[model samples]
Target: MDWEEHAARLADEVTDRVSRWREPVAAVPRHELVPRWWQQVAGEWVLRDGPCDLEAWLAAAYCDTSLVTSIGALHADHALGDEKPTGLPTSSATLPSLVVRFLRHARLTQGLDLLDLGTGAGGLAAYAAQRLGSRHVTSVDVDPYLTDAAAGRLARMGLYPQFFAMDATRAIPGTYDRIIATVALEPGRGLVPVLRALRPGGRLVTTLANTSLILTAWKAENGGAVGQVERDWAGFMKTRHSTDYTPGPDALLAHARQAEGDEVTAGRYPVLDVSAAWELRSMLEVTTPGVELHYEENGRRRTACLVHTDGSWARATAEWLAPPEVHQGGPRRLWNELERIRNRLNAEGQLPLYGSRLEITPDGVCHLSRGKWTASLGV
Candidate 1:
């Protein structure tokens, strides 16, 4: 298989718009950074190493899509036949189109310094060097292996930047004309570092850590930056500190195990995965706190539970032929609350986070103002 031909074909696919930075993308061998990738197998994700097939690897790497290099911050580490799911990406190089879209936003000049966070596969950094020169760009990543891998990939293409292995949450070594974070920023995640990294009036484009929120704010004259959500939507893998996500043994498990009483109400809303709900899920995590949801489905039984910190709980379980019997306990009946919220959305035709206006305070509280209710978030 001719790998170079595969790479050239991909270059042609993304040619017209990327022409300015064509040499960088075309020449920098993508197969090097993602030498070994992951695939889900038998309810688990597994690794498939490369330098293997030219046609297949090219198709996978340059297909204009997101390749899940890591999930739940466990980067393709766990061995097969031993664990339940493992290897969430601590980091990754985002898709090519997303990278170029952001670069187009940057509007690079001949000599402007950029702080590229989450260096990932180093592909974007290489493109930056091509556009603005290698001396002007600085890339940072939390994982040393990732930074090193990116460094090597960039070196092979004869492009190099001040690539450093450091946490972006800490002090940025120097001020930048533009700072673009590929990783999303969470509320509890500090903002001082990013603000301090930017020179006054510096423009920053990044997504809110876990939500479908994209922001393009400029550094303010006073201290912080101010901006609003971008009309479009983009989501990245959540940042992580632990080796793997241990969301605890499902806080809702016990509630589901022993459900009973008239507190049980038969409800009728198509069950949704709480994790997929983003903003509302985060809001519930904050307002109610310490809550968790669990899912289990067999040929016969299907169950899900919503459990909270203050011991408030709700659960639903059903055999294949029957509707779920809902149960509740503790102070507030959580399931009842969920049903109510869903009903409200049905009446209103939308949920709060969808197209909701956001005002981020100087202290980093995200106040989502929409319609009648305004939610003030804790920074």
Candidate 2:
């Protein structure tokens, strides 16, 4: 199979949907960027080296799906078979369609300076360079190797966007007319640096970490940014201070699965995976941040578990549509909180998350308001 032909066809399909990004989508070689990736097989992540199987490589590259470029610090470059990495994905080539959608939200035009935040595989930056000139684009990531590797590949294609290995959550090197973050920013992580680095009147596009909220703001004259949550939802891997994700809630989850809790009650509804329910998940994350979730379905027995770094845990199990049996431990009764939020949803017929108004202060305080409810992140 001809990979170029496959890529061209993929570009055509993508352009049909995102008509504005057609040229860049057609020009960039996604297959080259993701020559090796991790694919889960029977609960273990295994390497899929594209060079070894050209047909499979074309198929995977052309498909509209994210490819795991790195698991923890163990990037596909150094990873081999059967050796399962313990942590979650640290980096990935986000699905091309979503990448185009992000670019669309950025409202790009020729000659505007742009920063492609989180240059994992440099796919977004490459597309930006292809649309705008290479000199107009700059890309940054915390991982040095990702920047180095992406730079070489991008240069080989005659695209030379400035690449930096720096923590984007902190100060960046230069200001930009537009900033688009492909990585998610954690709650309470203020947008001050991002706002400072964005030119006044320039637009910023990014998502909050662990939630499906897409934040789009323009730098205000008073050193802050004002924006709203976009109606469409998008999720990205959280930004990291280091190469791997922080140690997760493995211990909390382990204890929650088996240990008896302080209180046990029946759930108002069947066991539900909060992660799958974006609006409820976002509201819950806002109310109780830093929660990790795990869910499984075994025939009629569906189970949902929540664990937090603050020693809070909850387990809910149910059969089919029956109410769930809930167990709560630690300081918070998570299932009850969820039911409260769900009750709000039932009463209002919609969540306040989508289309909510956002007011970000100069010092990084993010105040979110929709109707009568309000929530704030940062001080």
Which candidate has the top score in TM-score? 2
Residues 4-29, model 1: lDDT tens digits: 66556666666565466555566656
Candidate 2 C-alpha error for residue 288, in Å: 1.6
Q: Give Cα distance to truth, residue 54, candidate 1, Å.
A: 3.1
Residue by residue across 267-322, what tens digits does model 2's lDDT show?
89778888999889888888887788999889889989998888989999899789
- Candidate 2, residue 243: lDDT: 93
Instruction: Give the C-alpha miss distance for residue 47 in model 1, angstroms.
Output: 1.4
* Model 2 TM-score on a 0 to 1 scale: 0.96
- Per-model TM-score versus the true fold: 0.79, 0.96
In order, the Cα lDDT scores of the candidates are 0.67, 0.87
Model 1 TM-score relative to the real fold:
0.79
